[model samples]
Target: MPRPVRRFHPLLFVSACAVVLAACASERTLTPEQYEQRLPALEARAEANPSNAAALRDLGEAYAQTGAYRQAENVLQRAEAAAPDDPKTLYYLGVSKEGLEQPDAALTVFARYRDLPPRSRFQQLMAGRHGWLLRALLRDELAALVAAEDSLTAEGVTEAIAVFPLTYQGQDSLYRPLGRGLSEMLTVDLASVEGLRVVERLRLQTLLDELALTQNAAFDAETVPRLGRLLRSGRVVGGVLDVQNEQLRTDVALWDWPSEPLPGLSSRQAGLAELFALEKEIVFDLLVQLGIELAPAEREALARVPTRDLQAFLAYSRGLLEEDAGRFVEAAAFYSQAVRLDPGFAEAAQKNQEAQAMAEVAGGVDMALAAPRRSARPPGGTSLVHNRLTLLNQNLGAHVVPGDEAREPTADVPLDPLGAEPIPDPPPPPAGGN
Candidate 1:
């Protein structure tokens, strides 16, 4: 369905300011336009360079200004799909939807826009749009909370839990990349503990794709039960990430299927720079809540950090998220960073090579990123952001090898598994290599 047209201001057309959009493009000079004859040229520009996200955005804006709200919504969405998470793209999407009177959908995009970090170059615009939209939806916010509370039930259930991708619910979008990255890292770390049947990342992606749930569903409360039931999980373990002062805090909850509550909630806090240890703490607490007895080997693994090099881990986590989002070219950049940061990081190196190859293929990708840029690094940092207002952080654990289709937990942790046995590290690939 398309959003309806609410109003059209003819004088505000593309001729006024062509807004030849690009990332961080506030200074990009726009072509002067008269609202009277600007639409065709903007459309031609977008058609000529289908991969030019800035041009697409400008075209969408032109449509909105002309009162073609439905067309504006469709075009703006395409811009968003290509640019993924660009605040300008999202802002236009929100504006188009707002013009069509779909405040609910508009608010979602506005939230994503506002949640972006300080350096996104659109912070001022995001803040203004976010404030107005938030005020517009104030009444709906309370209604949503009340509805969610009323839907809750305390029905007892099995111990199985599926940790959905962790999300950044804070006020800035800088940490958004860590949302899925943390989930994947948790899955890897939790896999170290015996008896827990962590859902593989691929299978969850498959399910989400099949169900046609948008990425937003991972952050939606209403989707938790359906997601758990589909995966046959007793609870879905995922939660909000927030940074306050120098502290990074995560609140994990197990949303039992059928809207029940379980004894599966825990929180972990650490200095923004000390997130590697926090990952292990979350795993331990999850195991304890699930009644799993960890063997000594498992205990040891939990105590150990996945990697001592923080920069490599950060690069890997950024790659992890880009990969999950199907932005292979973007992912390749981060993976390349990881490999460069730690030349010994074989898994990252391999993934980087693969992503670079895949991205360059004639797949349905925009030409901008399709051409491999091995030296590029996605938007993120090797060091922790010290801003008292925000931060983005994630640590890499073991690289996951592919597994069989995910299934329910059929058994408990047995004694003397990897946890009980002293797992020996392989001798550094036989000096020169294996």
Candidate 2:
């Protein structure tokens, strides 16, 4: 007021302009219905400015939200063609294709989005959804294929062999020992089948860890080769598990693993399952991969396995390993722990029964050997049960009661009748570090 200062009003004017621009940009007043209504406006905008990829994409999304799939697809495809390198345009194209029930094409579009650089949150969400949809469509298709094949087999047309190995990389890592154990069990189960060989691949844990250490792992060559090797099988089966927000999202693939010559099932992704259903599909796919048809009873058996508590399953695996080695005493202990951990574990229950029985037999043998023998000068006329017990003790390599006049056996006598060999220590840690 003193000097009527007109000093630097320009700075205030610039600040006000920036605030107005930000407000305009921040506005999200469009509802879903409003978004749908905006499609005609966006389409007109795109027609006026033919090079405006943003307008084209917005129109596509609006159309998609309104269930105009054909129009959405047309607009999204045009946007994708115009901005061939834009991840957003490609993502919309994928979304539109999914709405159109053209999942295979949608998978391609989503795959492109996955490969794009500077991935945004929106892109990640789309990719995750796309991955889920692809697996579901693939599994449905494979189920149909398997049913058709079963009908053919019923007609005595061709003997179809399905080999499903839960082939994955990183099996050797501590982080994924359960996966390795499951893979080993699958291999062992399939090994007993005639006319089928489970194609095994090296566990990925070591390689991935090594790459992590070296910091030179590129996705293109490394990941591509691993995936290609998996798909090389006539019928390849695989799954991917990702941790998002403390939950696991799994994607399983069961289709032709083409080598030099692509197989009939190469083009389509088939056989998908999610979460708990995913585990069932994995076991089921393995049966199909091995050409072992699942009857209703066998299907029920497969369905009985647990999924959520991987820790309990690992404990069960340890029990099975001990049981297989004939360490009944140790196996019983492990199985007991497994049962305590998971009361509902059916496989553990079965193994625990066998282990307990064997443990009882072992205990009886030890007790008989540890029992005190009667004095050398025994009273006359021992009962038949005593005699039988005495004989049983001797048969089990325990010291027999001797008469007063009897002399002890020479030190060179081999007293052990069971001829048990010394138990070797577990095999040394695997080479190149366990």
Candidate 3:
């Protein structure tokens, strides 16, 4: 019998395991009652194996499901220490933080979630969560800053610049959207300059809208200083765009806001087709006027254009307008058009994802509910082969099969996977594809 021992078939083993898992996943469902039933067993496993991250994560999630956030937080912290960079653990930890009303801590956790390379739908959901939380925090901070506008000084925000939407002085409504598009381009380019901190376009717009400064009046040189003071910006950039006969003329001014000094103004003219080149010239000129010396890499980055296709830029600009107005659905549509027109426009692609995710978040899609849970490996002392089989079998909803010790499956699996809720179809592309 020893001489006739047969060879182990690796491929057959893999195929058999795959078939079993496929068959079992079809039967797994963790209803509320099942999760409740598994709580005691999950607790026992964690208690017996204090250092097992998997066991702790399962117990913490079960506790979170039962609304015991404090206990969940305690175990999740242990799980995070044991399994650093585990998205599942970090996400559940963030939920516990939110339930504990720790917005700052939750933001930090979600920021880590956001920085992780985009790999799954759960990561995408975290990106949206991070953005939504940031905006909410910014709004609260802005209210306090505005109330103390008089106390703001040049002591801080010295290197900050705020770019407002360019004033449009043209009869052709078709080109009006460029006001926002040009301002956004300037903001992005100027941010490349070292030693300068550009206020985000969205944040600047939010503040302007909050102060009612955007309602009836255009942002002129006189208004720049006032806005800079309110925004705690040391420098403010505002400009006018005059277009006639397919020719473009730009008048840009930089106000040294805190000191109430005379602003430096510059003008440039170019054919509409040469908009990108003209914008580069304006950015360089502003840098020179501000006494900023650009490093070679910074100069190179500034020279890079976002898009060569005018139509794509137009679509992207329209998306910005829609997004700023809280019309995320329309914004997503326009952004999608931009991507379709110019597939290489990275900014457009990122904005499109953000718009879609934001739309989902706004529609009351709970992040915790949307993310699927994975089974964790059991604690030490078991054979590696048996441990893996146990975890895989539990994940696939299989019953314990002739195992060393009888154990129940972790009840963390989502009953309905995120795939059940597809990102809503972007509304049909604009009529005539424009």
Best by TM-score: 3
* Candidate 2 lDDT tens digits, 1-434: 11111111224434433553453344333345765656555666666655656666666766765668798788878876777756546655666676677778877776664465422323433444453454455446544543454233222212222332232333233223234345444444444455554553222222333233221231222343333332233443444433333244444444442333322221212221223454555556656754678667755665654424444455555555454444443444444445555566555655554443333222221121111111111233332222322332233211122121111211122211211111111223334531
Mind giving the per-residue lDDT tens digits that candidate 3 earns over 317-346? 877987887765446555666676677888
Clashing pairs in 3: none
Residues 154-195 of candidate 1 have per-residue lDDT tens digits of 343344556677767666454555566677778777765666
lDDT by candidate, in order shown = 0.53, 0.42, 0.65
Q: Please give the lDDT score for candidate 1.
A: 0.53
Ranking by lDDT: 3, 1, 2
What lDDT, from 0 to 1, does candidate 3 have? 0.65
Worst ten in a row by lDDT for model 3: 397-406
Distance from true location, Cα of 406 in model 1, Å: 31
Which segments of model 2 are wrong by more than 4 Å?
1-31, 151-181, 184-434
RMSD of each: 21.9, 36.2, 18.8
Which residue runs does candidate 3 get wrong by more than 4 Å? 1-50, 153-157, 215-218, 260-265, 294-298, 326-329, 362-434
Alpha-carbon shift of residue 79 in model 1 (angstroms): 47
With a 3 Å backbone cut-off (N, CA, C), the pairs that clash in candidate 1 are: 15-33, 15-34, 115-172, 115-173, 116-173, 297-419, 298-419
